[model samples]
Target: MLLIEKPTRPLKLFSLSSNKEIAEKIAQAAGLPLGKVSSRQFSDGEIMINIEESVRGADIFIIQSTNFPVNDHLWELLIMVDACKRASAHTVNVVIPYFGYARQDRIAASREPITAKLVANMLVKAGVDRVVTLDLHTVQVQGFFDIPVDNLFTIPLFAKRYVEAGLVGSDVVVVSPKNSGIKRARSLAEYLDAPIAIIDYSQDDAQREEGYIIGDVAGKKAILIDDILNTGKTFAEAAKIVEREGATEIYAVASHGHLTKGTAEILNAAPIKEIIVTDSVKTDQALPEKLKYISASDLIGEAIVRIHNREALSPLFSYQPDENKDDA
Candidate 1:
């Protein structure tokens, strides 16, 4: 006879209004019902959040991504964390799938506010015990937090897709659309076992002038890696330069698929083969036939499982592309 044993303590998953679909996916993947919540706004534009389910002494994970309407979503996350703390939940973990304001991680100019650090401080102040975020604009932002934080990677998923598409080989080159993404591009390069190429760039009159390719891209397949694809100008310029350098094929990969403001048209006109990104950002229209999106939900779900179990989530950072396939 097989007897099922129940858990001594239950885990509770709460979803903020920020991104309900991804939150629901996480709960379903973990075999748990999403905790109920009622969110509203006052006449004065103040946001309010009320948890409808009991969470006392239970491990709680609140999911909210600070995307567009960034201020509102960020305020919601802060309020939720504070509520969870006062409700006596044993643990309060804030799972921000796409950490926003992450681009302003440092002060490049005098008197400039380090908004990323401010966000970190705000979370800690609002009673977040731990944090789980994916592909931050800068990894150093993790250091701004004193609490435990697991900075997840989207490269493994990208690598898997590339391997499946049979793109890994000596002829492929991973390109960083900007110098800021060189670190991320290098990580992908290491996974594909391919060389790295970088596009030298400078801004002039609100426009970008692509300089030259740092590595040999002549007669090689090219893959550009970035954390986010906003306007697609950087990508367009990089693709043009690589193609002019005699690259046979060009591909793009980003963790957060913001793909905003005519990105589709820009990408369509560019000399690119494929564009891949995760579903962190919701999209109603189907990605262009040339684009492929790999889900980071499983990786995120596994990280949540490990965090709930009090296990180290660091091991998930390493990439292991399968031998039979080579597409991410």
Candidate 2:
């Protein structure tokens, strides 16, 4: 006999202080209104979150990027999740555009904490049913969490942008500043139909100053790719390397642009021509003219819709957003 199932819970979207701009865009794309949420800080640097509307028996998705001030934003997300659980929300889905502490995924030294796994444990303990985030620093971080994780890619977004800008073909070469990032660079290289190259480091300091290109970058438009653009040091160093190797033009692309202390000025003075990043994190600091931000709201918004409907999210792995829809 066919059994009847309970009706699907009402869907709700909420944004935290980290990235309200992208949250609004996601809400717009999902055809949903931003749910009421009030978050404030106390004198002693404590965080408090309140859900203004009833969320009982509803499916809730919270948008928060744990970028700078990582602790505070992370706490806010935990509190929000707890609140949802307490309010009887059917399921709590978290959308983290930037997963902080991701680089600390491995124990490089003695007594070092695998902070990425620790953070995953915290979120799981705090009750995040499923996690949806953009490119993680390391894909293996997914294994750290027992909960389901949908790690989206920004390759298609970056590819679409450059393809339209006419930055494709043989002249274009995707370069990974370090060896570990070859997979990311290869994805873009395949998308742009360009060659792939890597900048390998050497034990000898003099060797570093000499030829570092693993593949030919001479007279090519070098596109440097990475997961995070933190200090701009790596990109700047790689830019100089490519420039010295006879690369006529340079470009940098990453999923999250933290633009930490002195990063903007550093990239501005570097040999790079232009830098492109997604609106995964919000920043008020003055950015260089060479830096541009595109929105991942459509990509994220579509993922949220599909997740809520219990649909597959594999297509978003290489999802390309339209110029009109994905540009910030």
Candidate 3:
């Protein structure tokens, strides 16, 4: 009889205060325990982090989304990365489900700073070996980081949900809220074998003008897709236009649901029949009646497993039931 030794997988997962629920789910999917850590703030508003487990020579993954209280969460993530590096972790992979400051990827006007680049620089300087984020505002933001960046897409997850909801058909049209989201909307449309539509609009004095529907949405079920749903104003406005254009049913999907500051109320009152979003950021607020959430745990967990095993992440971008085996 011959005995074979099992290979060791040196991976450690940690989570900041940003989104603990998603972190726990990821850990469960990865079949690992969440690394213990504690954080506290001083009376003067300074943060201190202490990692309770050994990360020496281990691949450390810190899960934190820079969402509400953006600055605070950002600082916490930076501190965690620095701690892991100083503690001799082989690699510090920052898994930021929702990368804040992504909207500021480029300077649209004179003398405006590209804060996204600055954030990338900060993370690199803080000793992050790699970055893992989902559905970046712009594909160009990937260039902001010199280190490896895995910009995972939630399209497969969203498409899976739409199929499970029985929304895949010719009568369903994926609508882009703005020109920027045309590519994302098109991807979803392709996945469902549906048509695509774009909403054209202009804003003046903080008010949105009535949008024009570019494709045939009349008498069809419209599925509006975007990267983030911030104030829900834009989403609501687009939904209204689709409804007015004779859309039988309106459904909105976004990768990140930054539904803050009365956004939920706006969405609830809007004509959208259902608003689906991912657990990229914490959605613990008083959610609207039509809001639905899908977990990104399996997607993220498989990515982590592949990264730990030094495998390519491209295949994970597409929907694979075998890959997301434990997402349920």
Candidate 4:
């Protein structure tokens, strides 16, 4: 009998147009170079992606965040994945740092489609074997895809950041911008050994209640936490509410900073001293001085390496209030 040992598949990392800066950082952190690929848009607004190198039998990882100009970026990723599939790649894994259309997870009004599910279906149909995303707007969105979906958290990253800054004490308070964000706030609060507060201006189907801050923030330093910072209205309003409640200082923290039109003006004009966000969504727009970005490359890079090695990813998901927090 003849024995032929098949060589192990090679890992190939690629980056699309969106968030390539962080992709480079991820590649550097992973000790891998990004594979060559080119993208262009036709005069008619059609997108074309050309994989410069062969991907035959190679495990491919593509990093893309569908952020501003959402449709264009989404189309680019879908096209790239399809091209990889056609090129006989061994496997195609997608890392979407900022999942677009995730906020449309459900129908709030009549005749509205669940666009988040629709996006999931589209990606799965585009031949993705697995998906890695950061801090999904709704965890339930994972169920929308049949393929394995890993939703990584930014709380641990934020926890480490604040802890190192010596902001982990009783005088610190985690304030949720909305009622729905209380859980996110509470988690960070627990990590920091701080109390949690909620600024709720929820308008029920019947009545509209004015915004109020729950829990004590008087003379406390506030960290307003939210998943995404878009339009900046939520954070701006929440900061004002917290300020009115006698919070001495306010800092805004978010997983992804979309920072759409007028967001800088809004956030800068707010009473916030600074804003901390991850490099999940790369933006070229001139950022404000208050905006400080902590890199997520290390975390996502470690994740990619572990997944490539078929190692368990739970360690990356778990965090505690220990003095030494593990850096991903």
Number of the candidate with higher TM-score, 2 or 3: 2
TM-score for each model: 0.91, 0.95, 0.93, 0.93
Give candidate 1's error at residue 238 in angstroms: 0.7
lDDT of each: 0.82, 0.90, 0.88, 0.88
Residue 3's lDDT in candidate 3:
16
Model 4 stretches astray by more than 4 angstroms = 1-7, 202-209, 319-328
Residues 209-320, model 1: lDDT tens digits: 6478889999999999988877777788899999999999999888887766677888888998888887677654435557776666666776777776666777778744
- Candidate 4 per-residue lDDT, tens place, 1-328, comes to 1111242778889999998898998887677899999999999999999999999998899999999989999999999999999999999999999999999999999999999999999999999999999999989999999999999898988888888888878899999988888889998998899999988676777796568987999999999999998888998888988999999999999999988778888888999998999889977666766998877787788788888877787988863323432332
Q: Lowest lDDT 10-mer window, candidate 2?
A: 1-10
Candidate 4 or 2, higher TM-score: 2
lDDT of 4: 0.88
lDDT of 2: 0.90
- TM-score, candidate number 3: 0.93
lDDT tens readout by residue for model 3, 159-243: 9878878898889999998987889999999889899999997667869565788999999999999999888998898998999
Off by over 4 Å in 1: 1-8, 202-208, 283-289, 319-328
Number of the top lDDT candidate: 2
Error of 2 at 115 (Å): 0.7
Clashing pairs in 3: none
